[model samples]
Target chain A: MIEVKNLVKTYGDKRAVAGISFKANDGEILGFLGPNGAGKSTTMNILTGYLSSTSGEAYINGHDILEDPIAAKREIGYLPEFPPLYLDMTVKEYLYFVYELRGCRLPRNTHLKEICELVKIDNVYNRRINNLSKGYKQRVGLAQALVGNPNVLILDEPTVGLDPKQIIEIRTLIKKLGKNHTVILSSHILSEVQAVCDRIVVINQGKIVADDTADNLSRELTADHKLIARIDGPKDEVIKLVQTIPGVVSIVADMQRERGVWEYNIEAVEGTDIRRELNRRLMSRNWYILGLRSSELSLEDIFLKLTMGESVNEFLADKADDLEERYKEEE
Target chain B: MNAILKREIRAYFDSLIGYIYITAFFAGSGILFSVSSLQYGSTDMSGMYSGLFYILLVLIPILTMRTLSEEKRQKTDQLLLTAPISLTSLVLGKFVAAMLIYSIGVCMTIVYATVVSFFGAVSWLTVFGNVVGLLLLGAAYIAVGMLISSLTENQVIAAIGGFAAMLVLYLISAIATIIPVDWIARIFTELSFAERYSPFTYGVFDFSNVLFFISATVIFLFLTIRVLERRRWS
Candidate 1:
């Protein structure tokens, strides 16, 4: 378990982490989702007692990192953005050193071997870490963090540089570790978070924007749906008719997907579906309704909207009435 | 602390640093031994022990430059600092490791005394006193170098700064004479480690001088720990 309270870190005139707070329950994998300069790594560093925050406290289990650092640190295993490896040492040597560094009481033979097998680094045990590939190097980094079987694991961008296969392997390994240890994994990759994280906390510009379970976050962010329609009618009339329909917020004409047919994106007010009424109105006007389908928001869109400093409703409104404004806001 | 100490000692032996440092120590002291004992046919080891100050002056920086600087450069300090270990142990572990290598280097030079013993009656008490003096002086120098290493991440800068600082301390007695103010000159002379170390080389087991070298070592090592602890906030 972990708790952070009003953590603030400042560098001269700039705040790297601005009074942000969050918690991860026991055995929960909390994914810290953010883009570059999001203070994700800064938060993780403070939690692990690697860097002191300017004005707040972080606790591991029940021990405060500042008040009782040794006890708090004993409960954590941290893998920084960089692996923090000594390249000259062999993989086995490096892990053993970490074991002793953590002051593990377990027998090194069985425990170290078990960790090596858990992270799938047994084959490269004897090889020097400098000679290892990026994938193996990352695995060794993970293996070191799992030493002493600490209850909490704080990993920052654990799968940043690996190839696709290695990414999946590391994700699977993290998921397995989550069965026992409380994990706080930080990454800008949404898919990685969606795949492995039980709870997601979205941070942007040194602040927390959204925190919820993956399913709940997706549902709440996308309550307002957009519909794509293709109709054989005048663009002006189509826009005017959709505007008059109740619960239809805004409609923007898209490029014609077919010859002599117009495509329009229509956003409906939250908790409303204007599909049935619109279909009837187009039929009454003798305009051919070619097709219509709802396009629900994805996690990527949710992340972009939150990090762009626009609420989901405001983003949807902007997307319907003004495409140019949305693009500008993204920049 | 033991874990860090073991790794640091293994690191020195694993790289070319330990071998080169030991080789240089033997070569430099061998020349001094020949000049003092063989050339003059003297059974006393005071001259040879005096020559040790110069050998340590050149090699102490090389031995301790990487003690903390390399860890900072490679970012491995994250691993050590984040562990359950205290900062004091981390600093002391590295300090002790460098002292171990310097001690072994000094121990190997006892063979020079053995060779001199075959030619004339050598004073074992004098050799023992000088050996203790050499260990204490080397410990103090290593502590200073470790402090310099902790202040910077660049090994070259640590080495150069350590050598410069040691150079000044080594010549402190001579430099004191050029000072115009008598009281200030007296302070420098008293602070000069070479002046305090002169008694041990002459087979005089002055306990105060021994305490002085040990206190200097403890102070520098304590300062290194303070620097590391302050880094967590700044």
Candidate 2:
């Protein structure tokens, strides 16, 4: 288990990591999702004992990182944003160096061979790291981290630069690693984390804006009931008919789809399903209901909303104001 | 520490810098030895030892420049720092690696001394004393160069900075002679590495000078550890 309490790191006047606290249970893959300049890398560095925090305590398996650094570091295998590589050394030589550097007690040859095979770099093991492709280099870096078999693996942007196939392969590997190790992976890519992580901590501007399972976060942020409908009728008539339906709170003609067919965005009262009611009302008027679907926000929209510092209520209010302006212009 | 020591030593041999440094040391000392001792058929090797000291001012930087700086530049310091090793061991490992390479060049001087013994009466005491003194002095210089290397990520800057720093230490006695104030000049003379190093060439085994070189090496190594530790907090 890893726990961080009120960790803060400041560089001069700029606060890079501002008093963030969280915990990762054993055998859990926790993803740190953030944009550039967020404190994901800084926090990872501190956790790995590479950088000291200004005022806080980080514990790895009950040993405080600052007070008992050697023990804490012994449990962590870190792959920084840029994989620290000795370009002059071959893959085999580099892994051996890291193996000795970490003071691994396991049988050296078998351990290294297993890691090389696990990362699928056994073919390129004899080549110098400088000659390998980016994907191979990243695998070698991951292989470096796996040498000592530390219980906690801290990876920063592990798939920042890779082809889609390689990215998937790495993601699969991470998922496999997550079964046994407490892996903390940081990435700016939302789907990567959503696909691989058991839980996510969404950080923005040096603070965590949201933390929960991906499904929980999606469910929590998407509480406001909204629907999209395409109707074959006069735009104003469709809007007027949709607003009169019971439990329908607001309706706006979003955009014209085709000749006399307009797509409308409608909001309803909480816990109300407006789809059936709106469909019945529109069909009763002989206005064709071309298509209708509830607009549940995706994780991408939630990510933007949380990071941009715009709450869901504020977003809905902005849309309401836009609707009011459009109505006034028509009048 | 052993792992780091082994890797650094291997790295020295893996790149051309280590070969160039040792070859240059031998070549530079050969030219000086031939001109000062062999060409004149002089039995005294003190003048040739002094010339090797000057050659060290140029060659030591080449040996020590990339020790720590290249680790930072390539981000390999991340691997070293994050490993379960103390800062002292990390610094000492690299310090010892550079000293070992330098010792290889210093050891060749013994062969030169033996060669001279064939031609005429050679003071083995003075030659042995000079070898010990040179090793001690080279340790101090390597420590200083390694300290400068830890302060920057650019190898070129580390090399130039190490050269400049060693040059100051080499000329400090001459610099003292030019100073107007008596007490300040005396202090400069006291601090001059060359001033302390010259006595061993004459077979004077000054215990205090040995202590001085050892202490300088220890102090610089300590400061290098501090620099690395300070980087983590910063």
C-alpha lDDT of candidate 1 relative to the true structure: 0.88
Q: Which stretches of candidate 1 lie over 4 Å from their true place?
A: A222-304, A307-331
DockQ, per model, reads 0.73, 0.75
Give lDDT tens digits, candidate 2, residues A213-247: 97786566564478888899988878888888888
* Predicted candidate 1 versus true structure: per-residue lDDT over A1-331, tens digit per residue: 9999999998778888999988899999999988888899989988988889999889899999999999999999999998999999999899889999999998998998998898889999999999999888888998999999999999999998889988888899899999999999999877688889999999877899899997787666654457888999988788788899999887877777888798887887878988889989999998888988877555567666666654757765765556835634655
TM-score: which candidate is best? 2
What would the TM-score be for candidate 1 when compared with the true structure?
A: 0.86
